[model samples]
Target: MTDNRVYLFDTTLRDGQQTRGVDFTPADKIAIARALDEIGIDYVEGGWPGANPTDDRFFSEPPALKRAKLVAFGMTRRPGRSAENDPGLAGVLGSKAGAACLVGKTWDFHVDVALEIDRDENVQMIRDSMKLAAKRGFEPMFDCEHFFDGYKANPDYALSCVKAAYESGARWVVLCDTNGGALPHEVSEIVAEVVKVVPGDHVGIHTHNDTENAVANTLAAVRAGARQVQGTINGLGERCGNANIVTLTAILGLKMGYETGVGDKGMKQLKKLSRMLDDRLNRAPNPHAAFVGDAAFAHKGGLHVSAVQKDPKTYEHIDPELVGNQRYILVSDQAGRSNILARFTEIGVEIDPKHPKIQRLVEDVKEKEFLGYSYDTAEASFELLARRTVENVPDYFSIERFRVMDERRFNARGQMVIESEATATVEVAGQRLHEVAVGNGPVNALDLAIRKALSTAYPSIDGVKLMDYKVRILPPPPNSDGTDAVTRVMIESAGPDGTMWRTVGVSANIIDASIMALSDSLTYCLLKSGTEAKVDA
Candidate 1:
């Protein structure tokens, strides 16, 4: 064996934090790093130590990663300072991280303009920083920023920078497409030339997605003999983003036959790991993203579904299960009986394929969707609808009525303030309960009121919390004003046991829609709790 393994280096906590509107607290970094480590990444670049309070705090109390080496990122020593005395170098070398990635200017243009220093001094900075890191017992890595552009502008000087780091005991020399404009062919050719001086095993590739070819360029570099791939989960980074490590991991294992730290078991967690990153950021996952997207293996066309029914290979590139994803037979106007049965299987429901209610459920789903209810995004709600159509579902509770009021007035300090209060009447466990609660907003007030009403009947309701809420306004029916357009609300709730579910509701009024979704959320939570109690009993 020639050892065709490519190391996975994730910089989501460092470079990804540069993305606009992205600011990772120390806790976020720790959680993300643990998830990356659990997925068998080789190196997790924590952040720039001492650069920001969050990064400083994260490095101070970093998570205990079992497999991945925590690396701190920073610039090389400055022009006037010696590596041993440089405060920046000291910050990186002093961090609890086991490795350091010191980035230095590679482009002559940047050296002449950005740093305004001599080219030789820049190369010396690279050498001195790596030597100091090695002396401090840290695995040194050199991030050659703008390496591709620098090589195009001045190949000799660019080579000198990487050679100095590698010669001074840097374990890996990463070539970065800092501007993200390098094409795949250019990446392959440049990497091929670089490997002649630096061994292929010691070279790494880092790219941004400005050209939308970061993943392709990374694969091209790998084909040209680079052994390490630096990227972020879900392509998270500044300036359009970086190559998606999730997609690269799948392609490397399944498409290219290259071994990675993430083996078969970790490979299966690709979809979950991608979604976890988005969840931490409180952003919606891109449905069309490669490999792990919701639509990656979804078959919506009637013709496609018919072929996939016979053989999944007809439409799917790879088994969705291989990446912790499942095939989706989207029920729509074009859906057939095959689609409904496949969906039943996907949702873990067992019913006769010829059951008459199958058609009824399909009809109901289409009807509700036409009214602006999206089952694809609200699988919990869809599951309830499915069960209700085929079998009876336990009505844990029913809301008699609910009302919310918002009041704005001047407080004791003469400062204006706004408060919302909600009152709800519900029947649960054969008792009608009425409760009132105040919250920061109307939705929160309603949620609190409902929970208070159910306190005596269901104590477990206290453990369930709302994770996220999304609202979208759909086009109103003809003759209706924009303010009266149909509103859709989706509520994501998490149970005490770490299980999460999504429910949805749609109505002309946003408040009514929110209450509908909230009701579904509570119902789903109770249903899960009751099932678990049964299992425990």
Candidate 2:
């Protein structure tokens, strides 16, 4: 049984793709629209069909709109043009949209300057577009452009514009903040009066983030009985952006007790959706973005971690599962053993609270952080440290001798010479295989040197690869001297079996940090593989 009910309208393909440096092909639009339907959006605004060939293609692609109704967004009909003959309206019909939304000039200023039409003609266009769309067998959404400002200027005229949408057979009359400059107080007041005459069920809020109050204003409107909230994920769009669906859905479901998602898939999908979109757009996700952000559930500081240990609600407002997010307690200079234990335990590795190894782990982390190595944003690194501290016999094959010669001399063509050699000897059952490989980097040269030399003798060792590497010099405190810095490295790698994990390394020497992370990344992958194999068998 569900208690809360509020409609979710996603405009990611239509408006979110309008973000600068962002463009989605028809296939991309189809993928996102299907994802929206999977996530249970009440409406998926595909795009302005008549406006773009990509949107036109999306309609013809036979999309699997599982749970969401498809909508086409466009401007109202031209003032003098017949609505049926308008290219915009024909696009809506051709696209086969179950619903169509037409935004018309509502403010007197837009009527005069933007639409380049008289007030009377603008109203006529609104009526023609909606009535035409509805008569053509589509649910119509009327967007009263700048309707809030229009109301303040001429209350009677603004109401008349809304009345036009109603009489035009619009199923949902959406009040659009085209310029995104309306205040919450104004939105609530205007929406309150409009709802009195507009039939609350047929009203929706279409807002933008220009004033950075999209989230706040959306809350105000929902409080004022607006049924549908229009938004995009991550608040992405042209200029400022539209309201964020992630934020809106979270607030409505968790804070306002409204039913936004239908199942337990909500919380996990939220984080995944945010990351998937980030990957698709090739944009680094905003860590501070609410609900699905990386830091939304990330915990640092000994104090926050301590309280979270007792009651997560002390620092976390909503259960992370509510948004498909999970708590990540990261260990840093500010961390205590509790933080380490919490993180390790969550990942299924437990360290004894009274273990003598904890002292070494604490000292190692502090020394690295004191130099400039932070494990906060680098949890993959910290896990290696935790594993090393507790595991007595880690199968870590130490590096022997390595050298890098950048023969970049002004006198002659530069020759890069990197040679490293390493050894890894493992005992399985009753047999022992000792292998060695050499590679290019002081570390890589050493790793390959050991593996290359060893693989000839050991048939069990087959697959290997190094995938990703990241390095950052830890920042000094406000009053601390900046003379010295330690580089923290994070490396992600994968072996032949398709296993992948990140490892962290901290060293005063940048090369050593890189080596540490690489070595740990390999070991973590191997160790997890070994553990899983044993369990499966």
- Cα RMSDs of all predictions? 3.7, 5.1
- Reference-based TM-score, model 1: 0.88
* Model 1, residue 499: C-alpha shift (Å): 2.6
Clashes of each: 0, 18
Output the lDDT of residue 35, model 1.
92
Ten-residue region with minimum lDDT total, candidate 2: 528-537
Q: Write the per-residue lDDT of candidate 1 for residues 1-537, one digit (tens) a residue.
A: 255989999999999999999999888999999999998999999999989999999999999999999999998999999998899889999999999999999999999999999989999999999999999999999999999999999999999998999999999999999999999999999999999999999999999999999999999999999999999999999979999999999999999999899988899999999999898998989999888998999887768888999999999989999999888787765667787777778767899988999988878878888889987768788778887888777777788999999999999999999999999998877778899999989999999999998766778989999989899999977787777679999998999998888899999888899999998888888776664222110
lDDT of 2 by residue, 421-519 (tens): 555443332335465655554566545644553344333344656665677787656776885556777776666776556677777677667766765
Best by lDDT: 1
lDDT of 2 at 2: 30
lDDT of each: 0.90, 0.76
C-alpha positional error of residue 224 in candidate 2 after TM-score superposition, expressed in Å: 1.0
